[model samples]
Target: MAEKKWMPRWFYQLASPRWCYQITGKLLPIFAVAALILLVGGTAWALIYAPADYQQGNSFRIIYIHVPSAILAQSCYMMMAVAGAIGLIWKMKVADMVAKACAPIGASIAILALATGAIWGKPTWGAWWVWDARLTSMLILLFLYLGVIALNSAIESEQTAAQATAVLALVGLVNIPIIKYSVDWWNTLHQPATFTLTERPAMAMEMWLPLLVMVIGFYCFFAVVMMLRLRNEIIQRERRSSWVRELISG
Candidate 1:
């Protein structure tokens, strides 16, 4: 009799492209609906109900968009790098696909954060752009994302591309902490983190709640987008597989 090796079932399932595709198909609607509801409710609450900053006034509302996007950008990059690492270590095609999907979405989110930051800064800092530590690190993050995308595209072989991008993503992981702590490490104009796990928020509940909603909404939105992209990547890469052929024919 063969001895059984114990491992988490879901972890094994994640290695299956078919399972991933089907599971994400089931999950996509749930995330899409949640993202829609939370984003809409959160945006409305931030704009109408949340009290304005006494100093910044209505302009502070931009944080509702800017903060969530900024957080998501960093989070997505982390996910991408980790997924790439998994693909490299385990040779899981689904993980490689997930890493590839994360690049474009993260790059877009990074761009949004940068744009909103610039818009907010014009009013607060009396300048459209400044070479602040946090902002500079974030810009570097965008470049890292672009580099992964470009490197993957440049390679003709899929496996080679995945390997190359994974290495780049892993190398870029060093920047994540730098971006997070840039405000503390340097005397930049960028403000300190608004939300922290260790401390209470400095803002009122009315103001904090909507921001929280927006952050959750953004994460839901990211999940939906990532799953959609992942499914496509799976289908594209698995097109020759029997199950995929059956799925397509059906």
Candidate 2:
């Protein structure tokens, strides 16, 4: 099947900064509009229409944002790590662009997760913070993300910064697995997945379905935000190139 493909050998041309810029520019506004519609719609649906939880009451509504953001936080870290690995392996310039673009978004999501977790905990666990494995690991994940961003910006040379961040990203990968298992491996104040459909969703469809919409909206926002930042990175990095000159003029 791989051999039968009619695509060009240089299909990865999409990774080129200019190519990505041109292409993403065309669709970015669409993504932005979609993001606005979905996020606003989803938030309204979750907060206003969803049924209150039997156990936690309206407080469970926080999960509409928290759980999805937390999941995206972890997954985005993985995406950044993979981007770093690509830079390390193939020396692709855009990989570092993606990694650089990803750092702040990942950090913000981590903060949202931590903040919402604290909010949820106050009512559910009667405390705002705990040193449980999941909580601690998530904090460490936030720190690791900060380290990656710091190390990159701390360096003066672009190549040097990319290389440094790539190494840190690779080394920090140990935390993802730890964070994933923390909830299952040890008892914690945080609850496990509540909206699973194949297994069992803890809440009724009235609650989970809207939460799912919010989760998807969050993901769309993430993509739009990341790509918007990535475009800036590409411009900054490729300013000396001819394509950038045309981009600036055209």
Candidate 3:
């Protein structure tokens, strides 16, 4: 009789860098395809099918992009911080790499959110920029991401760099809740959330369904990009290893 295994074999296999590279390579194409299809389909549905907002008019359509990018930006930062914590706690090199990869991606997404918010604001609020609480907190979030990246790059020692960045990432997490609750805690120009966990979406289903698709597609795209960056990082860091040499030769 075969002995029962205490944990799934793949769980252990994931600890191997080579195995991770191979598995992520296989998974990337699937995520890439899904992201492309969903993004394209969602964009079409949003632009062509969804009706313009009665109050904000067509300018409100930017929400499809703005909201998803903002959501992803915050989520990516949380992921980075969590990965950094794991790396600091367990000394996991892969977790450190994941944390490093997340910084620039999160920063870029945050910028997208800020840009789209600005554009949406011009038509709605009649201003190019405002020092609203939500906006200011989001700007701080972007700076935190940049700080992590800059700190990691400034340090010469890889281990020290990872540890330093991990501390910074963990510290930045306090701002996330502030960003989320800024509108509620303070009188702000930005509107309340369109979707909420405790209540139905304020927008009609026709308006929100496309936004949902865009949000999912954005997440899928983030996964695809993060995995791509991780694979590159693994290759660069593991270049001296035999498996990487074999992969390069093959």
Candidate 4:
């Protein structure tokens, strides 16, 4: 029988570079337009409509970028690890493409996290850099992303590169737990999680709501960037194929 759903049930079958290319191609425009609308509108709302913190005042506003970017930085690494695992285990072309595609985007998110963290630190901790547990783990996470990117680019064969990078990503997962729990695990200046929308927030709504929008906006923005990179990866991996030629020609 034909598949009942829009997507195939077997993940390996769907991991062809060609398949990933077509799927991401269809999703690109929709994500692009939506991301633009949400990110811009949300940032404006967060920065302008959101109230200053009772203690930190307007300086707390850095959370709008810092928080989301940090969360995504960790998340993007996990996602890359999953893709790399599939590529290593199943030898899927799309898995390699996906693993490759996520590197630069994840690295960018890590940069955003670090910069915004430093910016936030200036006001909260009175210092730019700290070897705090959370901050240090987060820094390691950034380096891991960079390492995977470099490893993948350094290799000539996609398979070998994907396998090596996948191992690195999985080993790096230990840092994710450390990053998330750092505030609780150790005495640190970086504050605990604040802007929970689905649940209650430690702070008042006037201050937290816009931050929620900013988080969602960051997610949408990341999706848009991922799609853009995935599109390029598709082209690179499928350069010898017909669909790629058609896509490029068109």
Candidate 5:
């Protein structure tokens, strides 16, 4: 007989809700600690050590928060869409749970980005709001997040809801590129990206370093939040499983 290849045990464990919950439980604390340290240290560095913009002065510090939130929001949505696709394709409950958990977090971060952008704009643009291409596309991203959240909640069957939301997420994936390229495609008041792989930073190391810290801190924070939410989703979806029952009883 020909030899048959089987997936590794570790891969199977990763697909298990119980295993995922346990792994996340171990990981959550590490990410939480990292998030706390980085966010606090980054905030202090950004506020106290980083020099002010000659033109914008202290107002430029808000970029530490705004840029990170905006980046995280887009990243979260992309993850959610990919998770949703996994659920749809593989019928993996864990992927559905992950997708479900991502929506509210992504929405909240998107809102934070928008709010901070508005605040940053007032000083730079002398206006609180503008119909800029980037701004409008970001707004559409927020709406897409809301649509997935609503669709999931509205469906009666869990599997049906997952499928519906997955399709919606896939459709909405088109908007992500629009948001990314909006500035280049159209002349907008919004500034270009601060950090790009191909281009050297325009700002001094003192300015960009704290911003880098804040960005890393934001990513750690997102991991912490998403793991917490994913753990809850696992428990909720797997309540009937023996591990969940034991966990609850314990």
Candidate 6:
């Protein structure tokens, strides 16, 4: 009884699909509003107010979109893998759904990163394509996302699909650090990190501040989309449940 009393209410509540769906519904609007404000404000500030690079000039402005998408693409894979692991270990349906939802979103962001990188490359490197270490690893990351999506679609059993993708995602984790450190590890055409946690930004604040806003805005946008997808997954998976049925009825 004492142990039960000590247990957090939200801990058990997290296991309820209905609870999660309702909670996400409430939170989605807040994320949407914040994302809209930050993204619009950041885009305007970066494109208009930020000074051009002394070296790269206005071409460097692409970083405003490229960097954030790259960051999100990697972060989304990590989140998907962690969620997959949770589903595998504890058999959480919500966790499985979350992992499934992340694939398409992550894949799209990875493609955006690659496209932007290619566009940036033409000006800086005088070529649109290169087999550089960072570029290759990021390409592999895109393939990994695609593999997960493909595997999930091919498998008929939902449980089996989730478990299989979980293993694949875990295996793919090895590539993330490789993608991160490839520029350092190899003589590559791609530049090193613009922002590092251990040191001050290499670029000036005027340039990086809008990037900061864009990054935050991208994260907010990711949250909003993930929640929306999760809610839809819950509704589909839980359609037979009384709560879902009542929700539909009402």
Highest TM-score against the true fold, candidate: 1
Which 10-residue span in candidate 1 carries the lowest summed lDDT? 1-10
lDDT of 5 at 11: 45
TM-score preference between candidates 1 and 5, better one:
1
Candidate 6: segments with Cα more than 4 A from true spot = 1-11
lDDT of 3: 0.92
The better-scoring model by lDDT among 3 and 4 is 3
Rank the models by TM-score, top first.
Answer: 1, 6, 5, 3, 2, 4
Question: Which ranges in model 3 have alpha carbons more than 4 Å from their true place?
Answer: 1-12
* Candidate 5: segments with Cα more than 4 A from true spot: 1-11
Estimate the overall C-alpha local distance difference test score of candidate 6: 0.93
**Residue 195 alpha-carbon offset, candidate 5, angstroms:** 2.5
What are the per-residue Cα lDDT tens digits for candidate 3 across 132-250? 99999999999999999999889998889999999999999999999899999999999998755478899989999999999999999999999999999999999999999998999
Write down the lDDT of every candidate, Cα atoms only. Answer: 0.93, 0.85, 0.92, 0.83, 0.91, 0.93
Question: Which candidate model has the greater lDDT, 1 or 2?
Answer: 1
Q: Give candidate 1's TM-score.
A: 0.97
Off by over 4 Å in 4: 1-9, 197-199
Candidate 6: Cα lDDT at 198: 76
lDDT of 5 at 189: 92
lDDT per residue (tens digit) for residues 1-250 in model 4: 5664534556645776676767777988887777787778778887888877778988988888888898888888999999889888878878777778888899999999999989999888899998888888888988999999899879988888889999999899888999888889889877887755466788777766666767777777788788788878778767888877887799
Q: What C-alpha lDDT, on a 0 to 100 scale, does residue 86 get in candidate 1?
A: 93
Clashes of each: 0, 0, 0, 0, 0, 0
lDDT of each residue in 58-78, candidate 1, tens digit only: 998999999999999999999
Residue 183 C-alpha lDDT in model 5? 88
